[model samples]
Target chain A: MGDRAKSLRNTIVLIAGLLVFWQLMYAVIGEVAMRSPWQTMRYTVTLVETDFFWVHLTNTLQAFAVALVLSVVLGLLIGFALGLHRLSAEAMEPMLVALYSIPKITLYPIILLAFGLGMSAKIAFGAIHGIIPVALFTLNAVRSTKPILVKTGRVLKLSPPAMVRSILFPAAVPEIFTGLRVGFSLTLIGTVLGEMFAAQHGLGYLLMNAIGLYNVDVIMSVTFLLVVFAAGVNGILLAVDRRLHFRV
Target chain B: MRRVRLYQVGVIAGLLLLLEALCLAGVIDKITMPPPHRIAVDLVKLLLAGKLYPEIGKSLANVLLAFGLAYSTGIVTGTVLHGYRTARETLDPLFATYYAIPVFAFYPLFIVIFGLGDGPQVLIGFLLGVVAVIVTMLNGLDRVPRVLRKTASICRMGPFETAVHVTLPFCAPYLLTAAKLALAYAFIGVIGSEFIMARSGMGYEIGYAYTNFDNATMYPLIVLILLLSIVMNGVLTHWEKLLLARRGQR
Candidate 1:
């Protein structure tokens, strides 16, 4: 406990030092090109109180939530199908990986053409980007389940469905969680990219507006909020992963 | 082996033929989804006009420069941080924050600071690629076996020699994984930045086509970019396999 505390203290100190260094660099760069650290903070606080800020925040968050839910559903279904049947897995894996390897942004134009520039396009884009990781990871996890475990379950005369539920699903849960984490991150990236390319409103639009007006402080403030939101999302996922990653 | 390869080629060809048939049958509109032949013709025209090569060259240069900067800095910084656990812990939150903060959000700031040029594009790409590389390398360092470290020390190897001969070799797979991921991210970073604000590049061409509603041109550009990514990934994976084979021999 003492050692842990000491380590934590050292970490805090180092973080503080880095922040100071960042601020000093900003000071040296001056305010014409980039705002000072204090200026960015003040601007961030001011923006936080605005009604438009909340609306945009809600818009981005809603898109992200819908994307996340859809990805989890689709990923699990497809992953299960691929994992359960070896012949299907062998036939489909290459094509799936090929599609996955394609830079998703390349699909943006096609998606926009099909879905039009609206929430649907954003949601679909996010879902496509998010689903690949989950499907790939889950497929890998299920395929890698120990042969010994399957044999033991069969010897015990467990039913097929029971063996899967009792052995396979639990065995793959850790890897599934890893996929979930990656899927969530990709979802956020896709949503942000979608909004940036063409959107009427959201954080991406707001940032673009600030850029148009040359409002450096607002841009910096929005960037700070985005960073904080992303870190928070990652932290929550990490905590969930830790809690649910129990071995069979 | 021959049969399997032939089957794979047949499948790909069949898919292409099916797509072409759909376009010809008007099940898919040619305007929105052009046939492969049309795209091929357009690609040849663009190449002959000398427009495609320059644009591709510009984009490739930007990606390579940005990737090089990010790779060097990420590896060096990652190595140093791994040596000092205290430093790694301190930077962990910062790295997480930066990673999460869609680097795209700061495109405007970069443009403002560096102006509307390759400067900001490369900077954004480097920023995006470097963060992922650092995290991956750090994780790789942590996973280095304790036995390897003990053996190196017992052999009286100096710190620099140990790192070069033992630590780096062990982390080869992890580094390759990082390189693969970083390449993708760097591509997105550069293209996305260019899409929003740029004068010339493949991304600029696509963005121009979009504004003009020239789906024909836009579709071909997108195809080119996708092909580039596929080729790059195949090359990198092959390189990694060769490295791993050599390491295994060692």
Candidate 2:
């Protein structure tokens, strides 16, 4: 309870510090380039109520949902396949790490070329950004499962799939959850990035459009919305993540 | 290890051959991608022509600048913050959630304030990288043996001497890891911002070539960026392994 209270206090202090920083920056940069925190909050409230904002929000959410599902499923399949085979894992892990570190935004052109300009392209881009981390984490997690458990599974003469289901997956759950949390964030970033370029609708498109009009209010409010959503979801996942790690 | 390398080479070669075959068979149209070999040839031709050197140079310089700034500042800040437990704890949540928050969302606001120049791009790169470096630094510091500090105290070494001779050397592998991350993030942040709204850079050139449907230019540029990043990462990874292996030997 004391630890929880300390953490809660820390979080509150962090948020307050950030708000103060924002207000300080707003003062320095002035009204021309940025909106104050209070103004941004007010505008965000108004922005959330608008029908136009909902259209973009819905589009983004839909793309993000499909992309996330695809990423997790495909990432897990790849992870499990490679993890189960020592030779394949040895050969592929470095390549995956290299792929992960690349500036995938450069690949946006190729993705656009293949998927064309719309929802599918955005989903593909997001999934591409997301899949690597999930696969990498899951691969490590599954590989590191307790040797005794695997020996026990072998003693039972369990089939490969059954062994994985009964032993590996459960053991790897915490680390896999960490990957999913990271994947979630990267997928959101990728989806928004895809929309920023040559898209008719989405928060990213709205951002670009507002920039063209030099609309400080819209930019701040939208940026604020994105940060708030990303940070809030991440904070919740982080709490769960810590709990899972502590359990293990 | 040799067998693993062979398998990796085989896998990459097989994929490229498959892509080449698909392009040759017209199963994948020319518009989508112009075969891997063609991309290679174009890359060579583009390099030989030297038409885009300025943009490439500018982008590379910015990446290095961002990386240098992030790495130096991050190390210093991390070292300082290590002594301030309360501050570090208060900042923990921010560090935890930092990457999750898209740094690019602020690009528009940056453009507004900095007016769409190199400042925003470099700033974005620095922002993306510095936290990673700081986190890595903190992690490295946490593992430093108390015996080492006691030895420094016994020797009557000052803080600077202690850091220079002891802690920093102990943290070499972590510093390399931080360097790798900082460089990668710098590459991503700069190239990405350039892709979005820059007037000139390798990313902007790719965007330009794409809009004009200049597949020759676009494909080559994309291939160039990929090769550069992969090579840089490979070198850093190799160096990091060497450091780790040496440490293990001791």
Candidate 3:
């Protein structure tokens, strides 16, 4: 078989194996809580038919989109500013890493307290999650741009602004994109966490409701939709990355 | 670098003082944004009253247990996946997009499985930590020289011997990086889960304070968490530098 064909075959086999194991567990356990793959699949389809699912999903996405855009714009500006000077970058690097290590999730209450339990709180929570990674990585990428590239700009008689706009920016795009990808994931998580932590609306609220009522099927369905949404966005980004990384 | 380091410290200190003044002067809401001085006082009181240490210890214990589980599972599965090209191909897509999925989204399922206790918290922590470890370890494994495998075979080395002498040495740096990443993830996971649902932990304390509008207590706990993670990251950074320096010497 061709490499592509073999890969497809392997994936199918692995998926089949999982389904069998899932079904076997359900059969053996004979428990309502332990849903089989087929049941979860059916629940997943049924979930889309409901109006609340769309509402919650859209709210979550809206928060995520706003946070991501704001984070990128702010992060890029801050990163460029901080990264311009090696001395400054070096000085703040440790602090940034330390901050990144701290779990922003725990601060959800404070975020909500400051912004209130509305869309603002969710966006702020998510933007906080996305911003640090983007800023830190962009700082590193810009500051660490190869000296050879700067020399090229110098040889071209480019001014500082022109150099940054042309040479430095292009060189830094790949890494910034990398940070954005990480940011996107974190922001989504943050947004969901905000909802889940305590919100009047969003998929997270729906999830909490399900948990409270011991609605296993709804919980599984929501989780499935979450995965699908995440995978779709991530896949699109990866495609963009593959195309962009080489050209610039 | 040295001069800028001092500048950085001074800048951060100045910012904090400004924030402290802002809160104290009522420019910022005192109730919502407790001044640093008051938070510091709360911290001292908490320390003196001996209430903070046990919670710290509990959180640390959970983190450690989860980290151990994740590190082991990540290593074993990473190794297995690396050894099997077809299986790696089959599962790599899911692994690639794994982080995008909100881990807490599955908290309900976990609570159901483990029944609302440390079991669920630790399990979630492991789930978060293990993904990073597995990805990093796989990257390390990818960099293992083809020549090493050939040499190991020529020397009649068993799979175990080759792994220990050749693979482990080659993977050390990446493993270290992954371990640090995994440690951070594990800490985040456990603490985050506590915020979601837990009987005790630093996150719980913060959640508890926030619900009751106890800003004084909440602010101090938040600061404590910040300090703890910073100290931990600092240690990891120091070790990474030391290892890199030692390697550079060769």
Candidate 4:
């Protein structure tokens, strides 16, 4: 309880510090390039109230939701399949790490070419961004399950599916949750990145549109919203993540 | 090990072959993606032609600059922060949630502040990488053996000398891991910024090629970037493994 309260205080202080830094930056740069924190907040409220913003928000949310689902499902399947086989896991782990390190943004053009500028492309891009981390984490989690647990399952004459359901899945839940948290963020980033490049709808597109028009208010509001949404969700997830880790 | 290698090679070759077959069968159109062999040939031709040498050079230099800046500053800051427990604690939340926030969203703001120049791109790369380096460095510092600190004190070493001659050397493997991560983030930041809105660079050129329907140029560049990142990551991974192996033996 004390630790939670302290963490809450730390978060509030961090947010305050960031606001101060933003205001300081705004003062130095002036209205020509950016807006003050007060002005940004006002603009964000107004922007959120608008139907135009909602359309883009819905589109982004829809894509992000689908992408996240796909990433989690595909990631878990890949992870579990490979993790069940020691040799396959050994061969592929390095490759996944390599893939993870790659810029991936450069591959946007290829994605555009393949999926051809629409919702599908955005989801695909986001899923690619997310799937690897989830898979990598899950792989390690399953692989590292206590050997004694597996032995117990085997001694009971449990089938492979039964062994996984009863033991591996339960053992790997915490690590897998961490992976999902990470995947959630990366998927959001990837979706926004996709929208930024080729799409005509979404907050990322709106930001790009604002850039072209040099509308500082729109830029600040959208960016502010993205930061808030991402950080807020991640904070909640991180809290849950900590509690889970602690329980274990 | 050899069987594993074969499996890896076979998987890669199989995928390439599959893609080639798809292209040849017209299941995948020419405009979307050419055959694997065609892309390889074009990449070789593009390199020999030296058309994008300047852009490639500019992008790599910026990545290196970002990596160096982030790595050095992160080490110093992490070292300093390690001494102040309260400060590190206060800043822990920020570090944890940093990557969750899209650093790219700040690119536009950086562009506004600094203009659409190398400054914004390099800054993005640095911002993306610096936190990771710091976190990794702090983790490394946490594991520094107590006896090592005792040895430094027995030698009557100053803080600076202890860091240089003792703590820093002990953290070498962590430094390399941090470097690898920093480099990758640097590449993502610089290239992604360039892709979004930049005057020139491989990313910008690729975007330019795409808009112009120049698949010939675009595919080769994309392949090059992928290959560059993979090779760099592979080399570092190998080096990291060797370091760990040596440490294990010792």
List A-chain TM-scores for all predictions: 0.87, 0.98, 0.89, 0.99
- Candidate 4 has an lDDT of 0.93
In model 3 chain A, the worst 10-residue window by lDDT is A3-12
Instruction: Report the Cα interface RMSD of each model, rounded to 1 decimal.
Output: 3.1, 0.6, 2.0, 0.8
The candidate 4 chain A region of ten consecutive residues with least summed lDDT is A239-248
lDDT of 1 by residue, B1-250 (tens): 4555565677789988998899899988855678888887887777678757888899989988888888888888898888897667767656755655677777888788778999999998899889888988999899999999999999999999999999998999778877876777778778878888799988988888887888768887888888888788777777777887886841
Better of 3 and 4 by lDDT: 4
DockQ of each: 0.49, 0.88, 0.64, 0.85
Q: Clashes in model 2: which pairs?
A: none
lDDT of 3 at B219: 85
Please identify model 4 stretches exceeding 4 Å from their true place: none
Instruction: Return model 2's CA RMSD, one decimal.
Output: 1.1
lDDT per model vs. reference: 0.81, 0.94, 0.84, 0.93
From the highest DockQ down, the ranking of the candidates is 2, 4, 3, 1
In candidate 1, list every pair of residues with a backbone clash: none
Task: Compare the candidates by DockQ and give the number of the best one.
Answer: 2
- TM-score, second chain, candidate 2: 0.98
lDDT of 4 by residue, B1-250 (tens): 9989988998899999999999999999999999999999999999999979999999999999999999999999999999999888889999999999999998988898899999999999999999999999999999999999999999999988999999998888899889999999999999999999999999999999999989899999999999998898888888888888888932
Every candidate's CA RMSD: 3.2, 1.1, 2.6, 1.2
lDDT for A168 (candidate 2)? 91
Most accurate candidate by TM-score = 2
Task: Evaluate model 1: give its lDDT.
Answer: 0.81
Docking class of 2: high
A1-248 in candidate 4: lDDT tens per residue?
Answer: 89879888888888899899999988888999999999999999899899999999999999999999999999999999999999899888888888999999999999999998999999999999999999999998998999999999999999999999999999889998999999999999999999998899999999999998989999999999999999999999998998888787
Tens-digit lDDT string for candidate 2 (B37-70): 9999999999999999999999999999999999
Fnat for each predicted structure, in order: 0.50, 0.82, 0.71, 0.78
